[model samples]
Target: MLGNVADVAQKEAVAALQKALQSGDVEGAGKAWQQVINSISDKVKTDCEMYNTNQKVLAQRGYRMLTTEETEFYQKLVKAEKESNARQAFTDLITTNGGMPETIIEDVYRELTEEHPLLNKITFQNVKYLTRWILNDHTKQSAAWGNINDEIKQQITSGFKEIEVTLYKLSAYAVIPQDMLDLGPTYLDNYIRTILKEALYVALEKAIICGSGKNEPIGLNRDIHEGVDFNSSTGYPEKTPIKVTSFMPKEYGPVVAKLATTESGRLRTFDEVLLICNQIDYLTKIMPATTVMTAAGTYAKDLFPFPTEVVRSNEVKTGQAILCLPEEYFMGIGGNKDGNIEKDDSTKFIEDARVYKIKMHGNGRPWDNTVAIVLDISALDPAYFVVRNDADVLTA
Candidate 1:
């Protein structure tokens, strides 16, 4: 399957370069040159993997393998082929871009992103794995509906609300010495991948907690306004903030079980619920064993409900945890409708570098309050999805 993809990519890249040259379009030719190099690099990696697998299988079947001299010769052949391709790609790029290193760099950056006409590895594409996502065509007002009920001639009562969709711009850059371009495609590929990964991680971390209406995603912690209170013994006012107190593992089970019950008198199931907490809390408290005994066992690890996921960030406090249905979190990415890479090279005059910027537009918020249950460590017996002054036991 991968071999077929590589073949098609190689053919298309050659055709694109030829067409650009015939039209006397140097920028387009540079882009085509980069595409050819990228495609061949992918193919070479795939071929290397296949070669290793075949060699292993042949040895397992008691077949005679190539001698050390023959093996080294084959490896050298592969290296030469890759280097030959890289040299051609760089030569073509320099010729098309008038031998201006800066111009060639800009074209390479553009091709690596939106202009490549393939799956982009430079952006935060993995956000889809963490939240329910929708692609919006433009920045505009949108709407999401809530659950509806059926009754005899009953009219709908506020079943939907308006949601403003906004886009956030995230940008980062890496400075590469001009001498590094001569090191071949492998070095360039690794350099680009490293910078892009760093940029994506920054965007993802902010998306997880940035407040809404500030040109950022409405994060999970920001959307949750209520939680179980643990201040009954202190007699603090209802809306007053409380300090966290540690609890034993045996006490974790009962408190977690009580969280499954909703105010609607429905027993919320824990089949799809996930406990999100910091790594420190999970290692030192949540998963630890306790001395308390019950019908099932004496350890809290045996009784705690649902699987746990650690978010390696300080946003989740040391003694706090969140119980949530991940499906209820909605994240929508917009912009880049024309699939074009935006670039800025003004920094070259001052810092001898080019800044490649990709504008990412997205917003996120909870689909429903009930699906997000915030649990304060001080108050474990009760959990809250909605803040209520009268229900002081569950409001924090």
Candidate 2:
């Protein structure tokens, strides 16, 4: 009767711990106490029993039950509870930091919604359920599927894997409204872009690394041992290299000659190129222009539609302070059949060719103290090519 009473009391303690840990709205060490208790109940007794059994079986091998080890493991629960309190404190600090409350919320939204097109299809209820699961930081591996779709479940599983890393980088400052209070966009453009770009890169890298046959426990001889190799078989020759030449007046030879060497053994993809270009441009925005810029697009014109170069000669030489020329003067050297600069004939094709004659008026020049003259110069077929237009800027 006494043993049964002890067992009943122990079970009650375990249940209480589990219930406390599983509470929906406990703060600080209160929530952690439950987790610590539950952990102790689940593993400590089992480990103790196992240790005791092993000691009995291996008495000749100097095996002895270490009550101290079990006690130490139990003590870790206390440490874990303390850590939980630390987390709550950190969360409180974020709240009191005088920045954005929605920073974390927006981060959660971006992580859950952006990049994954599935977010568009999933219902709000399922999303909330998933969000709640995320908040709980629990797994459904032991549970039933419930009503969530297989696709959404798969996404949620995958997304959950990265939650730790995502949370580490996503700061509360991102969601804070710097300008208008509570009237700004839900997510900042910079933050959204940052998350999307990182997520996209991660997905791409994972796809490349975890491709078929690579996941075998013992990696044997297989194709794609290295990522650089692409099959040139089946009548597909290697893509031709792109050559870019700088614009030069017949007298002073071109100073720049740029080329993107096919990364040997690397199968080039349109999407990969596009991503590289976007990343390069984003970095370039923060840096000064160098003599030869390594960018993603085909030509200078592609980087900045209708690029131009100017000549400045001192009065002692030509007596002209500056000679301004429209960007059109410097033609895209290696023009495709349709006059548009080629961006890999292998994947994306360029067809339409229309010339724009933009005027430039600037300071300390033949055209001094002025702005650029925007002009659409030339008559050409616009059917084949898509014009890159800036809606904010005026066009002729």
List per-prediction Cα lDDT, in the order shown: 0.44, 0.24
For residue 240, model 2's alpha carbon misses the true position, in angstroms, by 7.2
CA deviation > 4 Å runs, candidate 1: 1-162, 179-190, 210-213, 224-270, 289-303, 306-312, 337-352, 378-396
lDDT of 1 by residue, 56-81 (tens): 64334222344454334334322533
Query: In lDDT terms, which candidate is top?
Result: 1
Instruction: In candidate 2, list every pair of residues with a backbone clash.
Output: 228-265, 228-266, 229-265, 308-327, 352-385, 359-373, 361-370, 362-369, 363-369
The residue-by-residue lDDT of candidate 2 on 1-396, one tens digit each, is 432453455445433433342343245324343333333233323333344345454333222233443334323322322454643433333234321232332343345444333222112211211111222212233334656555443334421322111000111101111121111121122222232233222222222111122211000011222243443342111122122222123211121111111113222111111101112222322011212222332223223212323211110011111111211011000101121111111221132211111111100100111111111111211122223445523553
Position 222, candidate 2: lDDT = 14
Model 1 Cα shift for residue 217 (angstroms): 0.7
Error of 2 at 171 (Å): 26
Give residue 271's error in model 1 in angstroms. 0.9
Worst 10-residue lDDT window, candidate 2: 360-369
